[model samples]
Target: MYDFYKTISKTKIDIVYLGETVCSKRKLLRRDDWLEIAEQLKQSGKEVVLSSMALIEANSELAAVKTLCSNTDFSIEANDMSAVQLLKNKPFITGPSVNIYNPSSLKMLAKLGLKRWVLPIELSKEALSDMQSEKPKGVETEVLVYGRLPLAYSARCFTARSHNLPKDNCQLRCLDDPDGLLLSTQEEQKFLVLNGIQTQSAKTSNLIMDLHELINLNVDVLRISPPSKHTEKIIELFHKTLHKAYSASEANRALQKLMPAGGYCNGYWHGTNGIDWQETTEEILCQLS
Candidate 1:
């Protein structure tokens, strides 16, 4: 984990969200370890935000969120409402899981100390623009430009169930599939991914082709969720594209090679099916015009 963070610190990415945002059972790193890593990343000139789990199902989980919210050094990314309540008026960012779908929700959160909010994965570009226009004075908008979309979360441990084991006694099977265990249809078409309690889109959500639109919408941050492999290269690709070192098409082509077998999707951004990929040629032309 230290080696991974070391590699990330060298990358062009600005913010690094570190924590166990999924199941609490995945105890490879404790709170102290996360804080230590956050400190290291901060020293390395990166803004580190500790992320809380999306589902606070237990007292221990709520306690963890409270502890993270209490940290004074770096900010916290509240993934659940419990975290938000704990972090009230403390100036924090909300992760994609918090469901800030409309301007009213955004306004309310801003009043409660939301400095930035990540657009929910399923929200369209149009929705973002509308919210961006009305978002409170100091609130920044972030978009998930790349990575597998975290579609939903469940209390049940699907990864453990896949192994026919109970949630408590199940071996840490999620560790076996780092990226996520892909689920496919009977026709062999790739579908959703089962990562313990989180359900993610099978296809990686790549929006390199929509960078212009994102910029036009005044997106403050473009998040690239780290995949299991080629993360550094992905960051480099985004940085280059953002700086005009690489054209969007060129970056898109390069990104395709780095992705796994399921291919890519940007349908949610187009206001369509979350698993479908929509071509952005016309949209890019419209934006340029």
Candidate 2:
């Protein structure tokens, strides 16, 4: 992901989420640092959000959650059930990592003061439509429009252990590969990326060209996960398309230059394999050109 302050200052992004969502061990930015960054982002005319860690284990981790919940300056996105419990009776954004699979759960969270939710990487358009149909009043839906799908998180630091070290003695190996260390099959085919304890897809999930479909679904926001580089260009493409200044094909071509590879997919949204891409039709391509 890009540097939080650098990105917020550079882009016309509507919302900026700060905090370590992957591994809490990543202490490059402390809680106070996040709050400071949030303050800076607020001044930049963006809605600032603090994202809770996806995996919370120890009491210290729980304490971090408490601090964020108690802070009244900005809203926080609860990623775990513990965070949800801590923030219950108070309004907060429910992140995709939470188990919000159906309308009942959505309503329950809404009752608990959840005003917004990011759709999980696995949810399809049909499911989203069904949930949106019965959403509680004032609840908004945001989709994981782009990013390396964060598949799973573990307590063990796989990246550290790979270099023959313990979790506590990880020695900040993760920083060496800012985008996570890639893992390939025995046959040399690239697969997953090891980011401390978080496992992400090797291929980044890009959805800039799916603006039409997202608008049709009535999605309120399209979340682009922070990339290590070229984030400004990616956001600009989306910013242009969101305002009808750029066509889908133009956005798609711009994204090719920003991805780790030329890989693009929207299979999860279409209810197919997660790696599938719904190709642009001839008429749509012609119009874009």
lDDT of each: 0.90, 0.83
lDDT for each residue of candidate 1 in 192-277, tens digit (9 for 90 to 100): 89999999888999999999889989999999888889999999999998999988888988998887769999999999988888
Cα distance off (Å), candidate 1, residue 131? 0.2
TM-score of every prediction relative to native: 0.97, 0.94
Candidate 1: regions farther than 4 A off = 282-289
Q: All predictions: root-mean-square deviation over Cα? A: 1.4, 2.2
RMSD of 1: 1.4
Lowest lDDT sum, 10 consecutive residues, model 2, at 1-10
Candidate 1 accuracy as lDDT: 0.90
